[model samples]
Target: MRRTHSLRTRLAFGYGLFFAAVLVLMSAGVYWLVRQALLTEVSQELAAAAELIQQDFAASAGPLPGFFSDPDVLLKSLPPRLTELDTPAFYVQVSDLDDQFSIGSASLRGQQLPRTPEDQTAAMGGSTTTRIFPLGRGRVIQLSAPLLAGGAVVGVLQVAQSLRPVDQTLQVLLEGLAITGLIALVAAVRGGVWIVSRSLGPVNEITSTARQIFQAADLARRVPAASAADEIGALADTINAMLERLESLFTAQRRFVADVSHELRTPLTAMRGHLELLQRGVVRDAEDQAEMTADLLREVNRLTRMANDLLLLAQAEVGLQLRCAPVALDDLVLEVVRELRPLGEGVAMRPQLAEQVAISGDRDRIKQALINLVANAIQHSPVDGTVTVALDQDGESAYLRVRDEGQGIAPEDLSHVFERFYRADRARAQRTGGAGLGLAIVQWVAHAHGGEVLVESALGSGAAFIIRLPLSREQETEDRG
Candidate 1:
C-alpha cells in the first residue's frame, strides 16, 4: 500500500515487518523484568539490614549512639553491596523515631531524608519509590523505612539511590532497538521493491510489444509466448488468440469489400459509358441504338440484383424474423421445381416426396432455399440429367435432399462449396453466369430456421445436399410467438 508493490513482494515484506514487530514487543516486555529485578534486590538488602538492627536491639536494649559504638557491629548491621548490583547503587540511613541521627551509608553522605508526609507515613518495615531526593548533581530513587519494636515502628530509616545505572542501560537498549528496527524496515522496503520490479518485467514487455505492432499495414502482429505457465503467460496466450481471430475477420472483410466494389463498379461503369455514347449520338442507326440500349438495360438489371442481394445479406446478418405456418414439404419442393423448369435442359425433376409431410417454417424463406437449391442443381446438370427432389422425415427433423446427376465438385474445392464467390473452376463461369452466393444464401436461410445444409458427394459422382429442419407444431408456435 505504501508504494508500487506486486502481490509477491507485499506478502514477503509484510511478514518480515510483522516478525520484527513481534521481536520488539518481546524486548519491551523484558524491560519490565529489569524493573522488577532492580526492586527485588533493593528490597532484599533493606530487609537484611532491618533484621540485623533488630537483632542487635534484642541483644542489648540500650538506645544507640552508644549501642553501635563498635564499628564492626555497626558495619554488619548496615546493608552490604553485592557484585550483581554492579556498583554501590543504593543509599542507607539510620535514625531514631524522634528524628535523632544514628548512622548512615557512604552513598547517602551528602543527602538528607525527607521530613514530609511521605517520610513520616511509617511502613511495617520498609517502603520505596522512584521519587527524587535532590542531591548535588541529579536525582535518586528514595527508599525510606520504619524500624519495628515488637509490633510497632520504633524508628525511621531512609535511603536514596542514584537512578543513573538503570537509566543508562535503558537508554542503550532503546538506542539498540531503534537501530535494529530501522535496519529491518529498510530491508523490507528494498526487498519489496525488488520483487515488484521482477514480477512486472513480463507485463512491461507485453505493453511495449503491443505498442510497436503495425497491424494496419500488415494484418499479423502477435505476442511472443513465454515459457512460464503463469497468469502473465496465460494473458499473452489469450491476447495472441484474440489477435488471430481479429486478423482473420479483418482479412475476410477487406477481400469482401474489394470484391463487392469491383462487381458493382463493372456494371455501373458499363451503364454510364453506354448512356453517354448514346446521348452524344455515337450510335446513329436504329439497330446500333437498340443493341446499346439492350446492353445498358442488362447492366442496370444486374446492378439492381447485386444491390438487392447485398441488402438481403445485411438483413440476414441482423437475424431477420421467419414467419411460422404449416407448409407441406412436398408441395413446396414441387413449386420450386416448377418455377426453374424452363431455365436449364428442361432438367426433368424426379420427385420422391413423402406425401403432405408438414414442416414448420416461414413459407417465403423456405421456398427461397428450395428454389436456390433446385436452380443450382439444374444449372450444373448435363443435358437430360435427372434432378431428384426427395423429402422425408428423419427423427424429429424434416429432410429435403436435392440430388442431381452432374459432374461432382472436386475434392479440393468440396469443403468451400457453400462459400460466397467460391467457384470450383473459374473458367466455367461463362456457362453458368452465377454470382456464387446462391448456395450461401440457401445455407443462411436454413440456419435461420434452426437447420443446416449438408452436402455429400465424390468427384465425378452426383452431389446431394440434405436440408434437415425441425418439423413440429410447437416449434412453429414458438417461432411465431
Candidate 2:
C-alpha cells in the first residue's frame, strides 16, 4: 500500500511543534519577569511622586474643592513646567481638590484624569492610593496622597506619569524575541528535515529493489546492500538473504525438470521401440509376446522406482521428517545387508558387524538409503568379485563401508556422482535399469544424519563407498548442542 507521508514534512512539523510549545512557555516566563521588574520600578516612582505632592499640599493647607476633590489647588502649587524636575524625561502631571496641571506633557493639553470620593477618602485618611488614567491614545499611572489640616482631611495630593518608558521597553523586548524565535525555529526545522531524509533514504532503495522482482513468476532480482553499520544495513542484509534463498530454489527446480526429462527419455524410447516391434507381428509367438510385455512392464517399474527415489531425496533435502529415538546402528546395518543378500548373488559376500552402535535416526529411511547403496555395489561388481560390508564405531561416530571390486568411477564423474539422474556410463545404466537416484538418496541420507558419504576410487581400482553416522544419542546431542 502506498502512503502519503513525506519524511521532510513530518520531521519539520515535529520539531516545529515541540520547540514552538517550549518557546511559548519560555516567552511567557520572560514576559512575567519583565512585567514584575517594570511594575516594581513604577511603584517606586509613584511613591516618590506621591511624597513630593504631599509636601506641596502640606505647605499650602488648602481646603479640598469638592467632597471628592477636583485636584484644582493641587495643580496650582505644582510648577508650571517640569523642565527643572528631577525626571524631566517623564511627563509629570498633577491634580488635587483645587485644580489640575500638566507640567511636562507636550501631548496632554486637556486630559481628564481618574478621581473618586472613595479614592479621595482613602488618600486623606492616613493612606495613599493609585489608579490608571486612560488618555485618548496613551495611558498613565497616578498616585494620590492626603494633605493634613490639623489631623483631619484637607485635600488630596495627586501625582501622575505617562506610561511611555515601560511601553517602549516592552516593545523592544517583543521585537527581539520574535526575531530570535523565528531564526531558531528555522534552524531546528532545517536540521530535522535533513536528518530524516538521510535516514529514510535506505527505505526508498528497498522499495525500488522489491519492485524489480517479478510477480508469480521466475525469480531474478537482487537487493543492493547499503554500506552502513546501522539498522538499515541490517534490514538490507535480511532482504539479501531471502533473495538468495529464492534464487537457489528456482535454480534447483529448473535443474530438476531438465534432469528428470533427460533421464526418462531413454527408457521411454526403449519401451516404445519394443511395443512397436511387437505390434508389427514380429512377436507372433506367445513367448515372444510375453517377453515384449515384460520389457514394457520393466520400464514402467523402473520409472516408478526412479520417481519414488527422487521424491524421497527431495523430501530429505527439504527436511520434511520429524526426528525419533536412538537407532541401534549395528543391528540396522546387519539387517540391511541380510535384506540385500539376494541381490549380491554371483558375487562373494563378506560382512564385518559392530556391536552396541546407536545413533538418533529414522530407521526405515536409513534402511532404504543403505539398500540402494549395497544394491548399486553388487550390481556393478564382476562375477565372483568380493562385496564386503563392514561396520565400525568410534567414540564420536559410526561408519559403514561397502566395498566392491568393480570398474571405478571416472575422476570427472566422481564429483557429480550423487547428483540426481547423473550416470557414469550410459551402457551400464541400460543393463542395470538404473535412473541414477540411488546415490543421490544416499547423499541425502548422510546429510540428514549430519554426516556425509565419501566415495574412494581410482580409474581401474575397485570402489569403496563410506557412510558416516553419529555414534550415539548422547554424541548426537552433544554435537547439536
* Highest TM-score against the true fold, candidate: 2
Task: List model 1 lDDT by residue over 1-481, tens digit each.
Answer: 5768656666666767786787688668777687668756655665565456555544444344543455565445444432122235665666665565556665555656565556656453355333555665665656566655344555565655676765677778777777877787678667766776786778878877777775344449877787799999999999888878889888768877876777777677888898899889888999989999898887777667667766777789898788888788888888877778877665788878765567777988888888888888887788889999999875467889999888888788878888766677665653455566778888888898899999988877889998888877754454456
Off by over 4 Å in 1: 1-192, 214-217, 269-294, 323-328, 355-360, 473-481
92: Cα error in model 2, Å: 24
CA lDDT, every prediction? 0.71, 0.74
Clashing pairs in 2: 71-96, 71-97, 71-99, 72-97, 72-98, 72-99, 73-98, 73-99
Task: Tell me the number of clashing residue pairs for each predicted model.
Answer: 0, 8
Candidate 1, backbone clash total: 0
Write the residue-wise lDDT of candidate 2 on 231-261 in tens digits. Answer: 8889988887888888987787888888788
Model 1 TM-score on a 0 to 1 scale: 0.59
C-alpha root-mean-square deviation, each candidate: 9.1, 8.9
